[model samples]
Target: MEEELISKKELLELKGISYGTLYRWKRKQLIPDEWFIKRSVPSGQETFFPRDLILERVDSILNSKEETSLDDLAKVLYGSPVEMNITLNELVERKMISDAARSAAEPFITGPTDYYGALTVFSIGREIDSGDISLDDAGTMIRSMAAAEDREMLRQGVTRLYRKQGVTFCAIISDASKVSMDVSSKLVLEISMPRAAAAFKAKLLPNKGEEEDE
Candidate 1:
């Protein structure tokens, strides 16, 4: 499905912000680079943004800027860093990782657990739940893949698992929606951020006043 897009001019007018501020935010990585879409119009090339996502994020930045530092805001917007440690109980309680995942992954984890490790466990749990791979096979795959020098790429900010022809690999990704295919003949599947997050049962931060009043 095509994303609902709005031109930069329209966005600036709607938000009452200047081009300078928008570009500044882009430079600071507050906005995803992929969201700044360039398209050809009859008149000329124009820059557009994903309407709903961009608007919601801009509103968050505006509402929280006074209280939250930009650096922290970036973390919240992207996701909490993997370096932030959380106990298995805390992970299950918050629903960040499932109980089954924790149990299945218990034997693999060493020392204190971090968000990255928890996410990896959760990912493998998904594969097991789908019957695409058994728990034991998933464990073996994890160990093999984790041994690579590029293993850090697996859990770096945002990670994506690419599976093709029964082979699976994980890598860090910037824009989740687009596939990086150098050749046109290569097949690709694109999943929107909202849908992917939903499939993963991930929780998104609530915008101000977005939650139902108690």
Candidate 2:
């Protein structure tokens, strides 16, 4: 499904931020370049953003800007590598993954999981929770992503699930633009690892004073 988008003018007015501030945030990498989607309009050209994503991101930046530097916030929002060693139980306790997902991933996890591993498990669990994919198909996704040698690709890649002849297949590509499937296969799900990781980080490690009394 195509993501709902909001134009630059609407976003600025809705968020009550100036063009300079929005562009400055873009320059600081707080907002990704891909989010600034430009397309030809009747007047000439205009920029649009995924509505929900941009709104949430702008709110996060606005709420944290007073306390966090833009560079640090960029690192957090952009999914910079951070050291994390968490157990599967801890993930559930933190509401990062559903019990159903943890049960599906538990047998595969031999020891403590890193951030990316946890993120992958979380993604699988989410699909299962949403009834988008079955638990068995999620296992296939886990195995495919786990076997990927390119950690960078896994870190910033998009995971796609496909079904052919009742058999499930998984692929982790650098981006959604790289997704290619045969005519015989049907694309089932596509999850962005970076976006998932960023959300996970925001949940697992909220900014200081986020939970404090104002």
Candidate 3:
């Protein structure tokens, strides 16, 4: 199915952001160039964006711009392998991961968690929080994600949960577009790592109008 799109004019008005701000974000690489889909309109050429993706991205930017520079925000949104170690407490305090995820992941966690480790826990936590996956199934998912040799793949790959014959399984694939599942298995959930990373980073940044305690 073709993606639902919103025109540039509509986006600007709906989001209450000026064209200059939008273009500035584009120049800073915070908003990807490819997302600007130009098409022929009756009035002339017009630009558009994937509706849901652009809306969420703009909200993330607006929420984080106060606490983070556009460059740092770009790095968090588009850069690969964010090099940072975060303690479990820090993750919770920063609102990067939910309490449900923390509870489900604490036993498996050893010490300071890296980006992928935190993402794995956060992803599983989301499933558990949503009541989609049981805590027992989360263990399997966590182990599978952790066992991946190329940890970087988990950074931008797709994570899927499947159930077959009363057993749960997890798989990570780089291209979500080409996913093919077994006929007998029931697909439970699929999380886009890139989107998850964006949301995570947005959460990591201090909320707008909120000051950090010294």
**lDDT (0 to 1) per candidate:** 0.59, 0.82, 0.81
Q: Specify the poorest-scoring 10-residue window by lDDT in model 2.
A: 205-214
Query: Would you estimate the TM-scores of all the predictions?
Result: 0.57, 0.87, 0.80
TM-score of 2: 0.87
Arranged by TM-score, best first: 2, 3, 1
The per-prediction CA RMSD against the true structure, in angstroms, equals 7.1, 3.1, 3.4
Candidate 3 overall lDDT versus native: 0.81
Candidate 3 Cα outliers beyond 4 Å, as residue runs: 1-5, 16-20, 37-46, 50-53, 59-68, 207-214
lDDT winner: 2
Error of 1 at 126 (Å): 7.4
Candidate 1 per-residue lDDT, tens place, 21-120, comes to 8987887767868779999999999999989778877887787788667766666565434244556666677665666666666666755665445555
Model 3: which ten-residue window has the lowest total lDDT? Answer: 205-214
lDDT of 1 at 124: 61
Please list all clashing residue pairs in model 3, or write none if there are none. Answer: none
**Rank order (by lDDT, best first):** 2, 3, 1
> In candidate 3, what are the lDDT values of residues 157-181, reduced to their tens digit?
8888899999889899998789778
lDDT score, candidate 1, position 197: 34
